[model samples]
Target chain A: MKQQRDSIPELVWNGNISVEIHQKENSLTYLANLPRHSYFAQILEDLKRLFAPKVALEECWLSSGKASIKWHWPVGVLYDLLSQEDPESATSVPVLWHLVFHVGSFPSSLVVPMGSMETFRTCFFNALKESDYVRNGSSSLVIALSKPETDTYWNSLLNHDFYDYRPIATKLFTSKSRIIPLKIYLGADAPIVQSSASLGYTLGQVLHKQLPRLFPSAVMYSLLKPVLHGIVLPSTVSTDIMNRDFCYPDGFLHIVLIPIST
Target chain B: MASSINAVEDQLSKTLESLQTEEKSSSLQEKIDEIISSYNEKENRKVNLRFKAIGRTPLLRKNVFAINASHRFDKVIRFLKKELGFKPDSSLLLYVNYCFAPAPDEIIGNLYDNFSVDGYLLIYYCVNVAFG
Candidate 1:
């Protein structure tokens, strides 16, 4: 049995290889690199099992227990396609990136979709509960909002009153100004309401524009499980846009902002 | 070709007869006109909406205001700017309920129908990051 198992190649994450795995103790490791192999399609099939509800999840990059958003290449493009706020006119990707986790070490750099940030953070916290760090009860997760360069440029443009006829300047500036920090207690028994802010128009725009581009990592994959099963809104608001069905008749969506500190 | 022309003539005469016989009583015509006018009035109806501030949203001198239902959402935005004396350069964000910032072109009545409560379409307006 050991010989037969040893004959099966261990999965390794070499950017040029497809379908590599390494078994370490009870943990199964998969690599992110693929080289135009047919198994790439098979790997994507396995990934679909982990997506949140209604995510296209057509294709993605998986490595070290982290999953990036679905991307496509058109003809001559070399880089993976990222989700855009404006898909119709979005020729370029946003400064923020998409990455979801299942369970592993936290990456140094990552970005969640605007509307989905709270859910991703909550899921990340839950995933941490299964890790050694939380069992020791010595750590907590922080969500911090930093104004990236793009945000600064947009805010500055609004501050300048660049468009006199339209209130785009003020709307963008006010809504995109700062990040509300959310501190999550690891392994808590109940959901935390760190802070709640009424969502504004510009933030809605940000959500509509950027929400689609989010790709949940493996650590956060639980949020998408209910979604994938066609449960429109899970019982938990901490997962996604709860009460999505009730949004239309009410003509508005009620969002409880989940705070994060990075 | 001649037969086709004859067919055309017959069709024309039928149309003429139909038109001539289509006249209704003057009272009926008046009622129809009234109905049409009422529909137009409904389309152009003025709506009164109540705006509320949540979190650190600035307070308005008068919270209730009447505006044309036919007006686009942008009109309310402009009205807000005027009421608040916000410089054209400053930023403002509006949301229906507490959740979404609607498109500027969305009609007021549509919003009122979907989200209005207690005779008010609860609008949460903010100066954006000012609250943060």
Candidate 2:
């Protein structure tokens, strides 16, 4: 018999998203259920095979409508962040996320060049250091990771192996850290909100402090809903649990806030 | 300019939606206008920034400046590159509190709010020859 209880990380890792990449001329459409916790860069090696056979991977980019996809964000977070654009169809249904693939041209001004493993690696670690700084007042913990250990950590994420990654990552997480690193996106066009929160503060408390008028109550989400890894999180979830289980591989909780429809 | 306006519009809509659920008041429109004005004021707010050089990069001649809150972190990078007189290809990485380099798109207002020290965002930077 299968194990009755799987860890939260495992369950989150197992969550997959139905994706449809629309290539030029619609001749090379790539469709699959991608891992929610994985980065688009992680699967690009295989996904690129379906289209852009002639172009270099480094030249390829993805866009939804007009916004260039930030490759560093967890694919799940991107889905949650983008889902707000069509809130009517976002509930209880597996929506095939449609993305446009562009090769050789990207918004160089807005985002750094991506598609190389090393580029993604650097971006991921840079974000990792940012989180460490918020937690420990410095990134010494992340900087101290040995070369071999760093490679292992990167490989764990690239391979989508959460179990292999957790033990190594546990060092960076501390209950005494200055604040829970959060990239809370209010909307597609809104400026992303990053706020400092004490270790003891619940998710609700943090939201209330960051956007007090909209999130008036610390115990309840009245005007907006917090979606993490595609699940609508109850306001009572503490920072500790969010940090431990729900933090994206880059070491931040990516919360997408959508207005609650009456 | 456009992104900040879009953000303000988004905030207004969300806040207005929330207010609709509140017990109806005679001055609801006034309340909405006040909230919108507050958001606009916030968008126009300025953030204090202090630059400290690490071991690799040289210390800046002038360390402190007031930056518009609506700008993104890349503007700071461009300012540093111009101030330091580094070539386009020269390597420079910036960190907050000497900790980590933020992504280019991170909004200036958010960075100041979360990581600023004594009302200033303590930015540390260095040439990447010593580090990545």
Candidate 3:
């Protein structure tokens, strides 16, 4: 009986595994029917396989009484992996590089967390400064304010507009331009407004009649104008409106019309 | 001399009968050839000719029309019928290359350029015509 007991593998009481260093408390816990040493070895092996063998595990600790283990790995390995898979994951990956390499033309709108616009703009400008395309005069950058802080900013820029600032590839970037109104709905529990369906219907009607006249010069106007001209009320808006019991659907609408440089 | 004359008459009759049969067969063959040539010409023309109707204009040109997601056939069909006063025939076969074959009622967006249609990356949408 003693010999049989000794021959059997000792059980390892492993607790939590947290991938993100920031979320150590809410880690995933697991119990493997293997010895403590072997369990640690398995984890190390898994890490080694996931990251290359060049990824060195710094430290690993097993709790005294609790079935928990804590480990730390290099941040460089994580950054490289994240950048390769998810371009938007890290703030360091230049957005212009992605725009140049991946998407040839600029998108109509880039939705980000509401408060992070400044940070995003700064990073975008920095990237443009470093990029070879901009340096070599292949492309130019222009920033137009939707609303000038004061008349002074506009007046100053307007004085030397031809000399100091010039249009890029016949494309103008300005926020002051009027956009087609889009109605968005938020649901009660959902992130969007609930009444967006009605808004979308109304917008669709207006656009169906008006779009052809608006974009007559566009080659695929018949196909694209009607769909794009109307206001979009996504389901996300529906949920938010319902949850908040917001009556003024029009107030929540965001209408920004801007031209993009190709 | 009498036997020779009789034999000559018999040979002449056989030759006349054969000539009549040959004339009928030749006429039938000529008709068949005409039909076959007509069909071949139609097939060739259908393969070569195409047509396109631009915008709300009532004019349709004898030009090839290629279809792409960018062309938005579903949206264009509605516009063409309702606004442009053009109706597609029921027999109008909608063909896309294996790469460009879009699903029925697929709402195409700007992102279509990123992907392929049928099997070929959708460069353009063209229409071919065959008149019998």
Candidate 4:
């Protein structure tokens, strides 16, 4: 008797991004008394310098057992940074830093599937291609040349006289892990709600809304939930949350939130 | 008294001789030969038998063996060894339902009797190797 074969493996991403800003002089006064504030302020300054005057900076936090943040500066800013001839600009250049942050006691010897790498490369290149400014410039021509041949293409892009992109610095920090728990913290000026039911209901609204938009063919709730919950969150976030506990049978890494304390 | 005993013994010996002659008249070997010849003729007219092996393992087994005809057995074996750490000395077992058979050493011209699926040749190996 013949048996049915299994489905192909799929790669997924999960994470979130947020942006905040403060007046430079006021931030300096506040940072002088508070060390933590100063640290975060320096990070914001460094990000502003890299992204430059016209670029928007977004905060992204990713947790896949391990949490990490990656700040992708705008292509125009990167183009400017690379082309600057000033000595001060060269001196102020940040180190090309790449660190894989591991948190929550997850193992370090985790294996990431080759398929996931391909998926990431495709998504990243596609995103770059879609940028209008990038597509119109001489840099765009270089990017086009670097499109999807091999690792050599990426290496060449790095060495090209167009952009200075580097991986983010990451460090592991411990915090109380949340299960499927939903907590609503309202701001002081908000109106008192007659029902708290509506508050918790919208917690997953963004995820639910983005699911179909991100993956149009995701029809079944069962299939959608696992893939969405696993890949969507960590990839979107600025932090790199590399989970080492699970492996998908289809040869991909599994990223799922377990009930830590519920 | 002597004349009476001799007459009785002579009648018993004649009865035994008649039974032996009757048994020899029937021929059982001729009937068996005729049945075997007819069965052989029917099989020869209907079905064709073929055999295939990879790395000294016959293809017909309980496991669904994926086989490729586009490449030689040596090339396939070399690829497997290079990519998947499969050794030449690994035992290959083939079985189909309750029937089981192993490939012999001299398999160069053994009917080329295997099916191919999706450009892969499937053979049951006694040694466990990862398959994609």
The DockQ scores of all candidates, in the order shown, are 0.01, 0.34, 0.01, 0.01
Best by lDDT: 2
Among all windows of 10 consecutive residues in model 1 chain A, the one with the lowest summed lDDT is A72-81
Model 2 per-residue lDDT tens digits across residues B1-132: 224345555676666666667745625334434554556466677889999888957878999999998788889998899899988667788888877778777778878876787778998888863365
lDDT of candidates 1 onward, in order = 0.34, 0.75, 0.25, 0.24
Worst window of 10 by summed lDDT in candidate 4 chain A: A166-175
Worst 10 residues of 3 chain A by lDDT: A185-194
Q: Estimated TM-score per prediction?
A: 0.28, 0.84, 0.15, 0.16
Give stretches of model 2 more than 4 Å off: A1-5, A44-50, A53-58, A85-91, A175-178, B1-41, B56-59
lDDT tens digits, residues A1-262, model 1?
A: 7764332111100112223443235244444544211122234434444442244432233333333321121100111212102222335332322223232332212322212323222322222221211112111111122335324433422232223312321222223323221111111111111111133323333222222111123223211111111112222333112211211111112222111111
Give the range where candidate 2 chain A is weakest over 10 consecutive residues by summed lDDT.
A85-94
Q: Sort the candidates on TM-score, descending order.
A: 2, 1, 4, 3
Which residue runs does candidate 3 get wrong by more than 4 Å? A1-119, A122-178, A181-262, B1-132
Tens-digit per-residue lDDT, A1-262, candidate 4? 1222221111111111122333323332111111110112124334344334343323211121232222222221111222221212335342322222222332212221112223334433332232211113111322334333334434423333111211100000111211111111111111111011111222234233322221223232211122221222322321113221111111112222111111
Q: lDDT for model 2, please.
A: 0.75
The list of candidate 1 runs beyond 4 A from truth reads A1-262, B1-40, B129-132
Model 1, residue B118: distance off in Å is 1.1
TM-score: the better of candidates 3 and 4: 4
Candidate 4's error at A257, in angstroms? 5.8
- Clashing residue pairs for model 2: none
Q: Put down candidate 2 lDDT per residue, A1-262, tens digits, no spaces.
A: 2453477877877888888887778576788777877788876656566676777777777888777887778888888877673334345565788898877766886656665887778778988988887787778888998988888888888777777787777767754575678887866655566755666668888777666665779999766778887778888888788887887777788888776754
